[model samples]
Target: MNLLNTLKICVIAFLFTSLLNTTTQAQITPVLTHDDALKMILASKKHAELSDVLVNIAIVDAGANLKAFIRMDDSYLGSIDVAIKKAKTARYFNIDTGKLGELTQPGGIIYNIEHSNGGLITFPGGVPIKNKNGKIIGAIGVSGGTIEQDKSIALAGAKSLLN
Candidate 1:
């Protein structure tokens, strides 16, 4: 009888622990809505317009999946792929693409890392989109402009979440 009671107590404890873990996981994993993606795109487009630069902007969710995209009128046709890869690259590694580029340079810590992951753009213009709590929820990538312009535009998009 004592053993039976002990086993029952253990099962109850395990169930309680599982419920708490599930609740904590749900709380930590925030949901990203379509409205959030549109906000980023609009902010990036506005910045690109101000800079007189035509570009393609891409957004990827935390899972490194494409969530949104915008190609400015007359933007470079080739930039569409570049923009998408930039967003994926940023979200996959959870770091800005420019910073990742530095690590992938010759003799760097992660040399040729870009050659992996079905091809990643390790250059500027990819910025990780973080929530107000500084948790990376997604990423933004801008292309069709100079590296500096792309980076600035991408930054503008990421900053939209904060504003």
Candidate 2:
């Protein structure tokens, strides 16, 4: 009788531990989906059209992997890589590239930091996408126009995820 009781308690504890682990895993945050990434690119394209600025847009997941990209007709070819770098930079740093640029000025604390991380685009146009809990899930980067224009378009893309 004593052996049976011990065995039963052990099984119950094992089941409880498994249940707790499952619940914890379920609470993990989800990454950006393809649908959300496409929506972001579309929003950025619309903004670029309205501003009459040809641009390249890139979106990366939480892991900084490219998920979606678009180059407007006549957009500069060089901007394709720039857009990707910007998105990666934003995700890696969890901050807008524009702000990062400021921090990398000659006399700034992170001077020349852009030379790191396989080359980062520390200028404007890279924005981190955050969830309702204020956690960053991805990033968007826009290039090909002026810095201001790129930043504007990128902001539009990032904001779309909020809605």
lDDT for position 105 in model 2: 94
Distance from true location, Cα of 58 in model 1, Å: 0.3
For 1-163, candidate 1 gives per-residue lDDT tens digits of 6999999999999999999988876555365567888998999999999999999999989888889999999999999999999999998999889999999989999999888889999999998988765788888999999999999999998888777
Q: Tally clashes: model 2.
A: 0
Stretches off by above 4 angstroms in model 2 are 1-29
Q: What TM-score does structure 1 among the candidates reach? A: 0.81
Runs off by more than 4 Å, candidate 1: 1-29
Best by lDDT: 2
| List of clashing residue pairs for candidate 2 | none
Per-residue CA lDDT of candidate 2, range 15-129, in tens? 9999998886555446788988999999999999999999999999999999999999999999999999999999999999999999899899999998887999999999998
